[model samples]
Structure formats: structure tokens, C-alpha cells
Target: MIDRRRSRRSFLKLAAASAAGWWASLSPAGFAAEREPHRKPIPSSGERIPVIGMGTWITFNVPDAPGPMAVRREILGRFFARGGGMIDSSPMYGRAEAVVGDCLRALDRPEALFSATKIWTRSTSTGREQHADSLDLWGAGRLDLQQVHNLQNWQAHLETLRERREAGEVRYIGITTSHGRRHDEMERIMRSEDLDFVQLTYNILDREAEQRLLPLATERGIAVIANRPFRQKALIERFEDHPLPDWAAEIECENWPQFLLKFIVSHPDVTCAIPATSVVAHMGENMGALYGPMPDAAMRERMVAWVGDL
Candidate 1:
């Protein structure tokens, strides 16, 4: 039976222990034995990545001032310290890529940094230039993944990405859309393109991707990265007054972020969920979803109904 009495504080304590490497020792069964952070594989390469990753959209777009930059550095430090792998950003987010470079430099370049960014320009030559600029901005020799942001001039940029992938400058290529925009075109790209990853917005409140994009990714063996898992804080503010459902304990969810994030990452085709946040406390809560039990299909259905009723 599940422990219904486990409060949010208790869950945080467990996460803190895990973060501090208290469970580093192996059990007699020859595994770490304690509940480790869940990982999902990239379908194209079969590479396993942690289900919870950091997103640098508005969150990391800070000025180079000492106080603001230091906060971002602490957030990045806590992220790597807590087993975060994929850090998603885009050139569209002003100064975010450069700030990420600052954080990496401050952290002495963490090995766990899975640098993922996008190309958001028109011409092939400009796309190439932007891609190179992102590399310099992030201080990465080669990007782990390069995507077409919002599919802007995707045809032209894709050609460049294909060449770069062949030239060993990028490990994977994909496209992304957000706020439920242009999914039909997104689906076409997913169907026709030989892409490795595709990112879209999916959350308890927004389920439009369920109809096509997600299943197509599964069919085509493309990894999925879910954005806006909290629906840009709209879902949180809507349910702040309401208490968590009693059954949330069944899957080890203690707060709204964990509850919502666990719902996204639990999807069979979702490789990871990139929830952007500037605050370290919220980042910790988001990473907490990486630990503990995830809901199965029946429970996910219940979650949908539970949130829909509110």
C-alpha cells in the first residue's frame, strides 16, 4: 500500500538525501537499490536521459549584472548537483544562451551539461552563422542537439542541420513548437523528416498533442521533449486554493509542480519534460519529479479527470 501520510516536507527530505549522495552505496543485489531518478531513452540513439531537464526560456534571460548572474549560477549549480542532464535553450530567448555560458564557466563546465538549442533564422547561411554563434555562446565544441525553433524557415535551416549532423558538429537534429501552434505542419515534418527529436507543449490542461504529434513520434522513433508542463503557471494559479487530491500519494506527488510534471513525464512517448524556472526552490520541486513513483495509464486518466473537474 502507498504511504498516504507522506507530506511535502518528507518528500523534500528524501530528495535532499538523494541529492547529497546518501544513496550512492550499492545494495547487496548489486544495484543502488534506493529509488533513483527515472530516465527515458532517446529513441534514435537509445541514449538514456533523466526525465526532468531544465529549460532556459524567460528564466535565464538575465543581464550580466553580478547579483542576477550569481542567482542563475546558483540555479545551474543546484541543477547539476541534483542530477539534471538536458538544459534546453534557444537563440530567441535574449541573452539566455550567453547567460548559460556564464553559468557553465562559473561551474567550471559540468560534464552533465546536455546542451540543446535551436536555429531561428531564415536563410541557410544565416542559420549556419547562428548555429556557430550558439556554439560560441554556450562554449560547446559541438551541440548535443540542434533544433529548428518554431519551424521558422525550417526547410532551409534543415538542410544546414543535415550537413552539420554529417560533419559531426551536431549529434541530433529536430524541430519544436509551443502554445499549440502549427501542429499540422509540425506533424508533417515529423512524418517526412529524418529527425531525432521533436519538442511541443503538453500538460494536464493542454492535451492537443495527444491526437497526432505524440503518437507520430512514437511511430517514427523520435524522442519527445515536453514544454510548458505547468501551462506557464496558469494551471498552478487556478488550483492554488484547492488542496491536492488524496490519491496523489499513490504516485508519490506532494505538490502541484510534481503532480503536474509527473503527469507529463509519465506519458509513454515523452522522453523528458523541460519546465523553465528561475527560482532554485521551484527547480528543486521540479527535479523532485525525477524521483518517486510515476503514475500509470489508469492513474493518468484519473489525474486528467481530477484536474478537469476543478
Candidate 2:
């Protein structure tokens, strides 16, 4: 087990000091942490994580109290029990890191967790500090993947990330943008930077990444993490009243969460798709996508055709 408190205190010192001169720190994985049915290897390390990872956008920004924290603990427990990995969060999400830390501690720190978070600060000098805060907040030993959230001050943060990666303080480095923002700039960075991963919005509705970013990730050997897989649950609410496609069961999609998530992760270039949910049942439905068959290129087109009509 990781001594998160000790790790946090140590990182606080490093994050606060002039040590490394904006060149340094935040950074965990355990057990096999990789579940069976389906897993994708990271392009840089070949580390396989489940395709249906959890996201903590609004779903995990709960108060640090027993009532809210207990529910979150169960929700996360359902995820790990379902063989999930690559739990993605950001400091920008209020109290999410702390909530997640409480949940992880509650769950006894599952061995299958692929902890991924971002450095969202625009100040390069405070970038390392933010990373440490995330580590401290999550009670995590280290971050498995540290991303430049929304590409804010991406260049400097990526430099610090590279240094941390070299020192084993960080594992993978990447940049992120969402809601179809800044594809042109993202493309430029993807081409120029030596990145291990790149996260952006890609879903049944958001196919823009397919035109450039998705293919570029494959070309550059950079893993891709798809966020807003459900368009922040708007897709689910929109389609819940509609019936699943008759062939939905062809891919073992039993609900909208499974249907929507399967469509995103089925894309060959997409490494994982994170759909946020606070409900235990919803989390179960999201994790179900990791099982059974996946949609193929033809089926994916059919998915777009169906959902795009609804």
C-alpha cells in the first residue's frame, strides 16, 4: 500500500521549494490493475487499462462528508469490482480530488486503479504546486498520467512533466481540450511534442476528433483518452426515452450508458472513453461497456446514424 500522507508531505516540500526550477513533480498503479474482457495498451508504455474508465467531472465534486463520500465510495467500488481502470479527474473540478481520495481510502485503495489527472494552472511556477496538491488531495502516492488541462500553458507544463517523467515522479505526459475547442492548436502540439497521451472530446455526436486528432494520435503513437463520452449525460437523457437499436445486443449493450460508451471506445484509435456518473447503478452500466463485444467500423457508422437522428 502507498503511504499517501508521507508522499504528500514529501511532494509538498518539493512543490514549494525552488528545487528543480519549474522542472519538477506529482505522480500510482497497483496489482495487475488491468482487467480482462477488454484493455488497451498505452502507446508509449504498452500498459493496458480497461477501456471503460471513470471520469470525475461534476459527478465527483461532492462535499467531503460522510453522506456524500459514502455514496461515492460505493460508486467507485462498483467500478473497481467491474475491472475498471484509468480514473480521470482534474483540480479544476471542485473538491473532486479530495472526494476521490476519501473514496479510495474507503475502498482500501484498489489495486486496479489507473490514476490520471491534470495540471490546470496557467502559471508555470505554480504548475508543480498544483500537481502536488492533487497528489495530496487524492492521498495518492503519484500520478500515473499528468495532463495539461485544456492546453492551458501547455508548453511549460509539458516541459515540467517531461522532467518529472524522467525522474519517475510522473509516468505519462499529455495535453487535453474539450467541447471541440482548439483542434488546430492541439494538432500542432501533438505533432511537435513528445507526448505519451492526448485527451479530447470524442463521442457518437462529437466525431470531429476522427477527422484529425484521432488519426494523429495513432500516427504519433500517443494514447487517446476520450472525455465527455456522454456529452456530460446530455446524450443519455436525450436517448433514454428512445429504444435501443435492435442490434444493440449485438455488442452486449444493455442500456444507454453501455450503448454510448461502447460507441466511443470501439473506435480503434481511442484508447479509453470516460463517462462520469455518481450513481452506483449508472457506474455499473458504464463499466458494462468494458465487457462483451465491441462495435466495428461499420457498426460505429450505424451508431452515428442512429444517434445522430435522435
Candidate 3:
């Protein structure tokens, strides 16, 4: 569950004061945690990653330009500066891989990056080709987690992924689906595959996963990555009009972004939530979810009831 600050101006004030005691600023009433952000373990290898990761779908597909490229650099800067890990991207996202690589190269490649990408092609042979291309584009020798995007030709790609995993060319292998589509298939696959992670759409509004996929992942011991957490910011545009509930401070959410992200990442079964953005300030706003104590089961119940009513 997540809490909130009333407005964007107030949130900016918190960001402005981030040079010192920024963690304290994430939650009013000074509810910041210690220096480190929250992290959860990958169930398979017990490798821990930050609760708040990033996604590069539409946001990182930038034209090769000084102006656009510089903005991306600042975004990555804020991300790493805030202790972010697990950057998820797909070759299907046009130039996002290259732009991310360029920005990472400019920043000297953050060691904190948990590089995640997907093989999106339909043919297993072409999926292998895309895997190699993705490495070159992202300038990575091996992907930390490689998923079969949208489960396209998933069976064959999973085999290739397992092969790479065995060869130390990949650390984790998984599958992804979005927008609440194909859960039956996802469930079937999850039950069968020797997967390390699974990515899906799980948010306050998209709670259908709570009924099945999340619980199943927990039972199967598969790490989960939540995508489209804001429903592509449509949820924010809808809920920002309403005043944040009074209990928002209890969970340390200082803005709508934090509120939404915390709701997803705080789930016991969810390892991380990947929210994409191009704005540097928005990146900071998203990372704010990493601080302070997370909302407990009781508070999460309250959040659902309050937001559902609104």
C-alpha cells in the first residue's frame, strides 16, 4: 500500500530538499528509513534487488540527439543515485535499448543496474538473433534477466533462455504479459516452467492478478516484476483529481506516483515494480516509494477500500 502528499508543488519542495535528508522528505512526519532503499530477494538464487525498478517501453526510445539524450542521462542518474536496480527493456521498444545503452555509456554503466530485457520475436531462431542484438545494443555481455516478451513463441524462447542461463550468458529467465491479458496461459506456463521471474500488470486498479497470478507466483517461489503499474499514467490522471486520503503519510507516499508504486511493490509476492518515465523529477517521484516503512496488511486493506470507494 502507498500514501501521498497533496500536490505536485509540495512534492517538488521535497525533491528540492533532497540534497540532504531526502529520505526523510519522502514521508512527512520524517518517516524515512535508513540509508538503503527497500529490496526483495529473487526466490530462485536469493539475489536481492531494489523494490522499485524501471521500465523502458516508450520512454527510452529517443532519437539520437543531444537534447533528448541528455534528459535520459539525468533520468538514469536519478535512478542509480536513488539505489534503483532491474531496468527492464525489450528489443520491441524501437530505440529504447540503444538509447539506454548510450545513456549508460555516458554514465559509465552503473554497477547497480540489474539489466533485464526480453526476446520479442516470434521465431525462436530470430529470438536468438534478437538476444545477441540486444546485448550489443545495451552494451552488456550478459543480461541479468531475459524474458520471453508477451509470451511470443514462449516455449522455444524459454529453451534458448535456459541454454543461455546454463552457459552463464544469462542470470535469470522468465516470461511477461501485460494489460491483464492471457493470464490463463501465463498461469499454465508458470505452473510448468522452471522460471526465475515473471512480469505482469499488477496495480491498485488492476487487481485481478491478486486473485491468481500473484498468489501462484508466491506458491511457486517465482520472483515477480510488475509493469504498467500506472496503467501508462492514466491512473494518475484519473486519481490525481481526487484529494489523497489522510492516511497517506502513514505509508510514506509523498505524491500520486509514490502512492501507486508502493501499492504494487509492497505486495509480499511482488519483487519489484517497473514504472517508466522520461522526466528527471518524475524519476525522483517514483523512487520516493523506496523509502520509509511500507504499509502493512491492515493499511493496504484500508488503501484499497479508500481508493476503491473514490
Candidate 4:
């Protein structure tokens, strides 16, 4: 009745068209377009955090007076738009906590934040009260994560946090240290305490973390949050005149800051990295690193060698 050959040819044509469409949809750019951009998942918890987050240290601790608050709002807005929600602050950062609170109020984006702050005093009561005040300042009834700022009165605070974490007041508890000088102590604390995350300084220039702390954290299945990814601006100053190595292009790094950021974050143990920046453009550039290719072990070795030459 029907033309069998014609029907077969039509079916084959339709199948080829459908397959082409499917392949187009599965293409790399198509997949990237459909997916939200973020990298670095917690090994223990399976929580995927954007590899690049904002840090509120000196830059964020700007005067809580009228004019400064207005400017910070823009910075906060940019950070939010770029998928950067983890904001690290502390009592030591002076009025940063209050300023961030004002930003949150101005932005009305509380749920969009992965709020992180520290307990930086010396007594258990002081630490507990400080944390409570941080919660109040941020206007978040519960803290997403809190850390012992530089291990100051860490044991006392850790005890309180362990109880509170069980009671569900704090979702995660950890420790932090900024300088390479205290890394030994940081490692000791890591061994002694059960922590959810450990915040430390790690950048291209400061590979001290590679020696022991990072490896130990990975072994213990502890998450690592890198602070001072710019080395407090030291890396930029040191490597400014020198052009970025050609190999860096393979890892998607465009400049020294981004190169250093990628270097620290490329470590398999690093869960997330927070690079503080006040400028919106810089924030956008940092967020870009989260989307592109991350360095493999061989690439990481090459990266280290490249930096070593600098």
C-alpha cells in the first residue's frame, strides 16, 4: 500500500535531525549556560559553595556613618549578583559586622547569604555573648557558620559551640588563623578539635598550607576556606611587573590576583576561597574563576613551578 523505501528514508532523516538537536543541547556551552556557576563542594557534607566568596575585613569595616554605608550597599549588591554569598567578618574587623548588617537590611537579601563570622574574644561567656551579638548584628536568628577567630579562647568557645550546634543554633563550627606563623598551632587545634571548616591564608606566594594543614584537613574530611587569597595584596605587588605565565591560560587565570586565587582554590582540599574586594568589577572577575576549568594535579604542579620561578 505505502512506499516502504520512502517511509524508511523519512524516518532516518527525522532521527538524524533529532540526534543533532540533542547533541547541540548537550554541547559544552549549552550545558554551561543551563547550569548555575559555582565550584568547590565540601567533602564531608556535600554542600557546594561558590569557590569565590566575599570577605569583609578592612574594606568592609568602613565607618558605619551615613556616607560609607551608602557605598557599601553597592559592593554588597555586586557581590550578591555575582553568586558570592559567603561573607567572612569578625569583631576584630571593628564595625564590619554592623556594616554588613546594614547592607543586608538595605539589600533585603538575607536568605541569599551564606553568613560566616568569628568569635574573637578570650572568655567562654565573652565568646558566647560575642557570637550572640554577631547573630543580632547580622539579623540572622541562627548563624550559618562560626569560627574561633585565630584560636583565641578556642577551647571554651568550641565547647559552647559543640553544645549549641547540637541544639541547632549554629549550623557549623570551625577555627581560623591568618598568618603562617600560627600554622603549627592551627594544625594542633585541627588535630584536637572536630571542626566543620578551617579558614586560613593560602595563595600562590604562601604555599605553607601545602606542607601539612591542607593534607591533614583532606585526610580528616574537613572543609577548608581560604582567606587572604591575594596574600594581603603582596602577590600583586611582587608579580606586577612580570607577565602572567602562558600556562596560566590553561587554567583560565587572566591576572595575578585571579592567578593566585586559582592556585589556592585548585588544591583538591580547598572547599572555598574568599577574596575580599570592594570594587564591583574585581568581584565579577573573581567570580569568573569559579566557572572555568580547575587545575588538575599535573597542572597544579606546573602552577607551583611557574610561581616558584617568580
lDDT of 3 by residue, 1-310 (tens): 1335456666887777774466565642243233678999999999999999999989998899999999999999888888798899999999999999998999999889899999998898999999999889889898899999999999999999999988888999999999999999999999998899999999998999999999999999999999999999898898898988878998878888998888888899999999999999999899889887898888888888878888
Please, what are the lDDT tens digits per residue for candidate 1 over residues 143-227? 9999999999999999999999998889999999999999999999998989999999999989999989999999999999999
TM-score per candidate, chains pooled: 0.89, 0.88, 0.89, 0.85
Question: Which structure is stronger by lDDT: 2 or 3?
Answer: 3
| 251: Cα error in model 3, Å | 1.4
Off by over 4 Å in 2: 1-35
Question: Runs in model 3 with CA error above 4 Å?
Answer: 1-34
Give the per-residue lDDT of model 2 (tens digit) for 1-310: 3789889988988787645433322100121133254899998888898898988998899877788888899898878877787889998998888888888988888888888999998899899898889878778777898999999999899998988888777788899999999999999999998999999999888889999999999999999999999889888889999999999989999999899899888899999998888898887778779888999989988998998898
User: Which of candidates 1 and 2 is the stronger one according to TM-score?
Assistant: 1
The better candidate by TM-score, 2 or 4, is 2
Higher-TM-score candidate of 2 and 3: 3
Q: Kindly provide the TM-score of model 2 when superposed on the true structure, using C-alpha atoms.
A: 0.88
Best candidate, lDDT: 3
Candidate 3: give the clashing pairs. Answer: 5-254
Shift in Å, residue 160, candidate 4: 1.3
